[model samples]
Target chain A: MAFYDSLFDSLGLREWCGAGDKGGPMTMAELLAKSKGTTATEETSALTLPFPSLDNLHAACEAIPRTRDMTSGVENFFLSIKSSLQFVLDPLTQPLSWLLDGSIWLFIAMPWWLLIGITLVAVYWITRSRASTILVAVTWLFLAFIDHYDYAVQTMAIIFICTGLSVLFGVPIGIAMSKNDRLQKAVIPVLDMLQTLPSFVYLIPLIFLFSVTESKLYGIAIILYAIVPVIRLTDLGIRLVDQDIIEAANAFGMTARQKLLSVELPLALPNIMAGVNQTIMMSLAMVVIASLVSAPGLGVLVLRGINNLELGVGLVSGFCIVILAILLDRVSKATLARVDVSQDS
Target chain B: MTANVKVSIKNLYKIFGPAPESVLEHAKNGVDKASLLDQHGHVLGLKDINIDMKDGEITVIMGLSGSGKSTLIRHFNRLIEPTDGQILIDGVDVMTLSADDLRKMRQADMSMVFQKFALLPHKTVLENAGTALRVRGFKAEEADVEARKWLDRVGLAGFEDHYPHQLSGGMQQRVGIARALTSNSAVMLMDEAFSALDPLIRTDMQDLLLELQKELHKTIIFISHDLDEALKLADHLVILKDGEVIQQGEPQNILLNPSDPYIEDFVSDINRSRVLRVRSVMQPLKEAASSTAGNVDYNDTLEDVISHSDGDTTKVYLVMHEGEPVGTLCMKDLVRALVPRVPSEESIRS
Candidate 1:
């Protein structure tokens, strides 16, 4: 003990670490260390597992292989490929971001009552049910009364853009996948990984790749998270097209393009619509996570409340989101159900 | 049956497998389906098929399932490309035609009716009927008009707006027939077209097809597993077994003399009197065989001739064709021809 103290004193590490002054609650590890013998255990614990510092991980990192890193070689590989990825992704995806930005601006600029009225009208058109339309109207009016009307509109805009883009890009990819076996086999694993990933994990890489200020960051994150369903369902819908119908189309000497547009697509529309419904729901669920990347929506208010530990703000915003989710779900579910009835029910 | 062949499928062979081209030589050298499948992992879909479908005649290809009858018909449109074949529709070699020409030929000269009433479920009955014309790039108005005319003719005038699922099986098939008709093609391929309907409905469909064929004289290639259906409708009958043509000729001739044992077995269960025509039993002109009591038309069924005779064994009637005495038929000969020609038990035992 004297030698250790002299060594600490000689090194002048006592001033830096504050010798013999333990802090905070004892972890199970620390308790066991204390039980081992208070003086010996603490000194040994201090030397071996001292309270965390900025370079704590680095201290023992040499014992672990770089190849077996916490952040994988795959992660590094993706980072390395970022420039090439952006080369293909940027200008091509610029139009999408612009469209989303335009929609967001439009929604924000519109009067709150007008957006609510449009929502009511849309719900009525889809369901043709008075009860459902009135419910949708009340929900919107409630959101407006709470002064979260603009926030709701922003959320709606993002959902619209993400869901629209998902269907637009996803359907064609699904069709191409169905048409070629080799491509389907190659793409399915990527889709599986995308879907099985935790929602927050998607935001991480997207955040690093694109700046937080860019709308494309959240837009891309939401799309990646929500796109799987539409692609799968479209592929399934087309594949589920009756073999006899396909044969009949072939017998009619219809062109490949004609067959797809006239027969296959019309037949697949109901399934594709159902896919869109799922995509929309997912986009809405992703809103809270998306708020972390500076997405302007009700999710932003929810995040703010959490950051500042304001219970009232968090609970109210969260309630508004729930109401929005329910209203959107009902309208879309009814619409999808109506489509299914026309097909085979 | 006529000399003017509308569609001639010549030397057709369809080998079905991953590597059919490699096994073509072995198949052409008389390798059977089973042996080819066992030895080479290839199954023969159609083996050296040859058929000349006559213009304005109902040519029915009769076979049980796996007989390549459907496969053979599909080859006419090249829907299932034959491993080796020549499909000549009119004087033009169909195999030699480019894709555009083939599409043109399909639009202009040929149409098909499927077994399952393969009407587009989303399309209304009228729109479904008009699909062929629309595919051929006709304006909607003109196509609708053409479709309306055919739909009326097929007894579906009142159900124009009904979807396929709303229609009965018979009505759906009528729509299928109408769709084929509206294409205004000279050749119609009906692949077991009425097989999916109920028995009564099937008979009605068959009668409708016959009535339409008589008036329009469209060259119809009908496929069926039922020998009765084949005999009832076929002017020329083609029988197939295990992807090869067993026999093909005039339907009456096929009933009278099935060359193969498989065919004999098929014919054994048939009721002969309804199927045998007067021309089949008629003899060369004999004054003794001629009768003034009634003149039987050459194409009349033997049952009709028998009814006219009223079981008078002495009655000998002149067989008339287009107001000309083509032959004479005696009651005895007619009775003898009507007898069921069941193969003896000894032959089966052997």
Candidate 2:
């Protein structure tokens, strides 16, 4: 009976009066009377011979055009538009190249040891732990000994810039998405596409539009890659806020903007901060990948060692990246912990 | 008693769905429930709710879950807009208020406490309490000062810096209450505000609310599912069921005579005499009562009157509203009042 029901449903025959009946075909009047809860004593069955086979079902289905054809057409249209955008953007990419070089040079010229010292102190102050401070200091010293400080600093600069941009752009987008369902629906597919696409795939079109020497090339790529976490976190944070709290805010006569700023945002701060942490981590991950395009960092050193077969250089560069990752992770985690503690008491 | 109604709601209907207005339009044309359901998956959250919340009175709307009690109160504050109705606050149609005006009305005239306490978890107790004032444009220092005063009023003076999650359920509710009161809104809407607390704490919170009401004289609209809480707190009680008002009257009247079988069933288990108090059911005391019975306090319960009297010819003393003697009762009358009636054998068997 279930199989027959499925067959009828698949064939779109359920809309007809005679379908879905197990007691053979019945007249429209008989079906209506049965639906109305009237008893029908007389039973008249109509048996038709030469039932249509599965091949006929398949043939009928093939006669109808599928929705996929329209989707593919839309996809091709978008592909063309993207390529056209890349062509227009190429000439504007050169000026950004000088800015990237200048920023890298500035970091390279700084007294690398002093930079490491100040970072250690800041980490210590933020985390408020002697062990974390010592670990940060030791990691920097080890990187300096291996002569990977310059590359590590370059990577740090990219992460700092990208993470900052991600927070700036992602938070507001998240807040907007939380407030408006239509905006959320519109933005979510884009976020999903960005998140699921391979990290290397992001650089392909970006490489076409922006020169590898441009700081904005890596900047834009890192932001695109890292922005999803912050946006998601912010949205989740605001969405997770108790509905009763929002209602309470409304009852208090808070304007929509006031409520978002004062109540919803404050309650969602932890989630947003967590998103910031994730964004930073993602930025660091993408910075290494950006090194392939001549963006300077520990990744550049690692790539150099791999290409030249210098085992010591690769290991040293890898160690520097780990130290940098620890520093950023510790500082952000400490900030988040402080937030939670302050909220508690 | 002659003060004009502060809030007047007429035929309020709040239906939740995309096409609520269209569905409501069909509903008014005598569309059957099934047809309405089929056309639009409309859930009648609130239906034809009419109420007048008098100035300085605590009106309690009581119902089981999904009975539209919460939705009805939400309509007055415009937290949830009614599909079709007129809600007048101080003679202004609340439904027609512009966004800015509505916000101003909320900030100045109404505040609400939620059952979950809804204290901002990120803000300190002081900041949470001061939020309403801050949003209404008070300066930081001024808001803090006012917030401290309300926090002190709610008995949390020393815990201003503490956050909401650090506080117990009752304490959190106190913070919520303080926040609502800090706004100094004439109308305070509390949605099951103390229902989440332990029984003892709930009683304390209830007492605190009564004390606050005594001093503030705010027009309070309190929503609760508990009948006892409603009876204890409300000046006027509105009983709702399935998006409709089943009964609305003074607590005393409703206790004495429930309007429908549903209400009768609802109040059937309630110990009426315990809630009624000496003031409600007291009669005139007679001069001759002093001869046969021991003198009982005029304010004592009937149970107290029964337990203290020891003699076989025990006479029940009647307490008058005023100081003068009015009437007396014997043991026979007291027994009749205390006993619960049982159905007859024939009726039970049938």
Q: Write the per-residue lDDT of candidate 1 for residues B1-350, one digit (tens) a residue.
A: 43598889888999999999999999999988999999999999999888998889999999999888888888888788889989888868888988988888887788999999889998889999998999999998999999999999999998998888888889999999999999999999999999999999999999999998889999999999999999999988999999999899998898888787777777877788888898898887755542356788988998887777788978878888999877887788888876656664524324
| Per-model B-chain TM-score | 0.94, 0.87
Error of 2 at A229 (Å): 1.8
Candidate 2 - CAPRI tier? Answer: acceptable
The CAPRI classification for model 1 reads as: acceptable
Angstrom error of the Cα, residue A81, model 1: value is 5.7
Q: For every candidate, what is the interface RMSD in angstroms?
A: 1.8, 2.2
Best by DockQ: 1
Output the worst ten-in-a-row residue range by lDDT, candidate 1 chain B.
B341-350
lDDT of candidate model 1 versus the reference: 0.84
What local lDDT score does residue B124 receive in model 2, on the 0 to 100 scale?
86
Residues A167-204 of candidate 1 have per-residue lDDT tens digits of 88999998998788898899899999999999988887
